[model samples]
Target: MRRIYHRFPQQIDLDFELARPFRDVLSCIARLHNTHTTSKGSGGLVKERMIIQVADGRTQFLDLDDLIPLSEKTSEAVDFRVDFQRTLLTPEKRLPVAENVFYLRIVDKGPVTECYAAKESPHGDMDAMDLRTFLKGACE
Candidate 1:
């Protein structure tokens, strides 16, 4: 099993600990496209897409070619949305149809320190003291 802790600039940090390996996540994404194609019983072009949402709110879309390289052990982040699409043969013509969508957020905790030490006080003001003071007391 592995654990992942993703920290945001202002938002709360997310902690994810799962039994599945990192490669399994990528495989699952690939399976989405496979299942859709098999179930549809179509030989049309199936596209496996991924949309990565950065902390700054920027989005980057990727195809299977782009995602294959990212399935390495060195990948520290897996925060993205996945979509499965295929060409559909309607009564009139062929059209692109979205089969499914999925969201994932898993960051490796390999670089996180065992203990975090705070030197300066946190900026937030609570009652009278800052957030650091409040946390220090609460942790103790």
Candidate 2:
């Protein structure tokens, strides 16, 4: 089975850079859970884990334990992308909002060189420069 390293909540945006190599592929697991309560059960829950190739600019979704080999001789930086879907549950008569809970996790990597979780805002700017700046000053 694949291992999870990082997790993020639903509807929240996340940005990070991978600058290291591991024995296997880098990945992220996204989980979604509905908060609505029904007489039948609690709510709906869904999970999607994608094996990501950090060096590639496009998004590549993979199955569980799927391995994407990395060239040890090559030196390149990797970027991560996580896309979430909207929910279909709503209270009484309010509009249905995409408010599911989610999380992100990386497989087997020992330690991440850098990771950043963008602030949750209705109009927050999650830009590349802002992420770089946040990572730069995170530990300081």
Candidate 3:
């Protein structure tokens, strides 16, 4: 007898640096927050999370609902990262295709002696960046 397997969700990920701060790296979450992702949901970023390394060598995190104020001055930050994720349908013609996981990432780090803002923007200039996407789903 022959056995068959059913549909299974596929995990996919694409990682690359924008090479630009996203307007350039500031090595701090505050500068990142003030940049493009300033918006949420329909206005801007669909989803996001941040991890920052402070002067004491500790880590701090922020979510979409909790934003760090620019006036707080995180200029001394040594490292930072941004994770954005959403779900979309895979392009496979196979049956039972549904929205799956997709992610966008940006990360930067340097010696504690360097300044973060002085670095180049990798993926943060919102208006200057570009992405190629295809329309897929049962409807299209």
lDDT of each prediction vs. the true structure? 0.37, 0.32, 0.27
Clashes of each: 0, 10, 17
Instruction: Report the Cα lDDT for candidate 3.
Output: 0.27
Q: Which stretches of candidate 2 lie over 4 Å from their true place?
A: 1-67, 70-76, 89-96, 99-112, 119-140
Supply the global lDDT for candidate 2: 0.32
- Top-down lDDT ranking: 1, 2, 3
Q: Where in model 1 is the C-alpha error above 4 Å? A: 1-18, 31-35, 38-59, 86-88, 95-100, 109-140
Winning candidate number (lDDT): 1
Write one digit per residue (lDDT tens) for candidate 3, span 1-140.
Answer: 11111211123133233232421333233443323222343333332322232222233333323433422334322223233223222344322211122222223333212211211233342211222121111011
In Å, residue 73's CA in model 3 sits off its true spot by: 2.6
Give the range where candidate 3 is weakest over 10 consecutive residues by summed lDDT.
Answer: 131-140
Residue 74 shift from truth in candidate 2, angstroms: 7.2
RMSD of 3: 16.8
How well does candidate 1 score on lDDT at residue 29?
Answer: 39
The 10 consecutive residues of candidate 2 with the worst lDDT sum are 27-36
Model 2 lDDT per residue over 14-97, tens place: 545444333322311111111123322235432222222231323342332233333232222233333322333445432333
